[model samples]
Target: MDIISCLPGHVIDRILSYLPIREAVRTSVLSKIWKNKWYTLPNLVFDKHGVSDVASEDSLVDKNKIVKIVDHVLLIHSGPINMFKFTEDDVIGEILVTDMDRWILHLTGRSIKELVLEFLTGEEEEEYYKYKIPWCLFSCQSLHRLTLQWCWLNPPKVFEGFRNLRSLDLNLVTVAQDAFENIVRDTSIVLKNISSRKGN
Candidate 1:
């Protein structure tokens, strides 16, 4: 028996699920049966650096290629994803931000259960330019976990109607300490865990 045929479908799926999205998609070439498996893996991860070969901002062609790959993955994933992760290196630059927001909106509309965003921003006047956390996330009825790293939030507010949120992790995120406390207090019924590392 062929090695690919020997493994059960469920077994293969389980193994693919653990890999980063880029690698998982590549497994589709293994066989026709595996072609659509990546779209239904229940987890979506988008990292520009992970899918690109260029190591620096000097190459615009490489950057565009990476963005297109990400767009293709999101466009094909038709299932309700369990988690969505978007991470980019500090050197990737700002041109990709718009595409990132578009992907976040798409995932949030799918009722993603968990969302993790890690991005870098300029240090000078840091408080003035904060990453915008898509509002759709706050309205996601299925969202239970949220993690934001090296991000900034302006006018941070408690998710007024969210009743399913359970865990929140913030690393190097700039938010009013009092506002953060109030948001937790207001969501006390469903908010069980919170870990934060304040930014400068």
Candidate 2:
């Protein structure tokens, strides 16, 4: 039996948390005791740097494969998904809207505590389209930390703000002044910290 496999489950999870999700999943092949350990990983991150490790830069931005990877993981994952971070470029942002919407809808049901979605849209001068955040995301009461980049925020009418959100980071996001004020100034929602960059 492998000595490392004898570590406590929480310790093993802590070790896995430091690794890229792909590497974390690969640990399942290490031993019987390690098998299925990755299935319950609370944090899932899919980003350009992570994918670049597996494929060339050209194939790294393959949005279809990115969608499939996210879809397949959420489809089979059995436990709670506490954190989900997906960072991709806006090269194919239009086509990925539906997938992004679906992914958020799926994550909301999992009691996601932290959600980060960054769609890099090249330079400041370029007028790339922004992905509008799904209304379902605002309803995720479990969210403690939320980060979004290069996206539009249009919360629905019935939208009450995230009750449990503690930190919010927005970079190059588009939101109506009133809507933004509603989140920050509203008495119902209390955010301990907020960091926002340029907005349009």
Candidate 3:
């Protein structure tokens, strides 16, 4: 008898959730009981750099692979997604932005809590162009922590701040003072830490 298999499905799912997506997915080959177990994970971290071992910074192959893997994983995800972090960009294919919005909108519908959007590509301008967050994020009351780097922040006029957000970290991002003020004034977020930095 397999002792590990005796554990509840939720407990095994929680353990798999902490592993990197690649590792988590690879576990499906272990046995019948392990097949599709990762679909229950609530946390999803899609870091492009970690997705491959390639050392070349300009590898379009890596970028394409990252996009394909992300699309596949999100499509098969069956359980509630509590957190989603996507941090990377470079010569994105024609459908990158549209695909990203589809993924972001999907997570929003799942009541995602912790969201992180970081663009660390060498080009700052392209990063901004690719990281335009979805409109749904502004009204996502389920969000509890948000971290944005090398992206623009344009909270909508009718935006009510993240009601559950406890931490906000923005670095090298563009955010107007008025939009920020609206969130502080209108939203009930008990922010524990709020820090932002600008690029030179």
What are the lDDT scores of the predictions, listed in order?
Answer: 0.68, 0.76, 0.72
lDDT of 3 by residue, 5-66 (tens): 66688778877967888889888877677888988778888885347553356556666667
Could you tell me the TM-score of candidate 2?
0.85
Angstrom error of the Cα, residue 181, model 3: value is 1.2
How well does candidate 3 match the true structure in TM-score terms?
0.81
Model 3 residue runs over 4 Å out of place are 48-50, 53-58, 89-95, 121-130, 186-200
Using lDDT as the measure, name the better of candidate 1 and candidate 2.
2
How well does each candidate superpose onto the true structure, as a TM-score?
Answer: 0.79, 0.85, 0.81
User: Cα miss at 117, model 1 (Å)?
Assistant: 0.7
Candidate 2, residues 20-82, lDDT tens digits: the string is: 877887888888878888888888999866554545445435777777777877887888998
A best-first ranking of the candidates according to their TM-score comes to: 2, 3, 1
Assess candidate 3 and give its lDDT.
0.72
How does residue 29 of candidate 3 score in lDDT? Answer: 77
- What is candidate 1's lDDT per residue for 23-123, written digit by digit as tens? 89888888877788888878777676356544565556666776788788878887778988877665435676677678778887788888888776456
lDDT of 1 at 200: 36
Q: How far does residue 138 in candidate 2 sit from its true spot (Å)?
A: 1.7
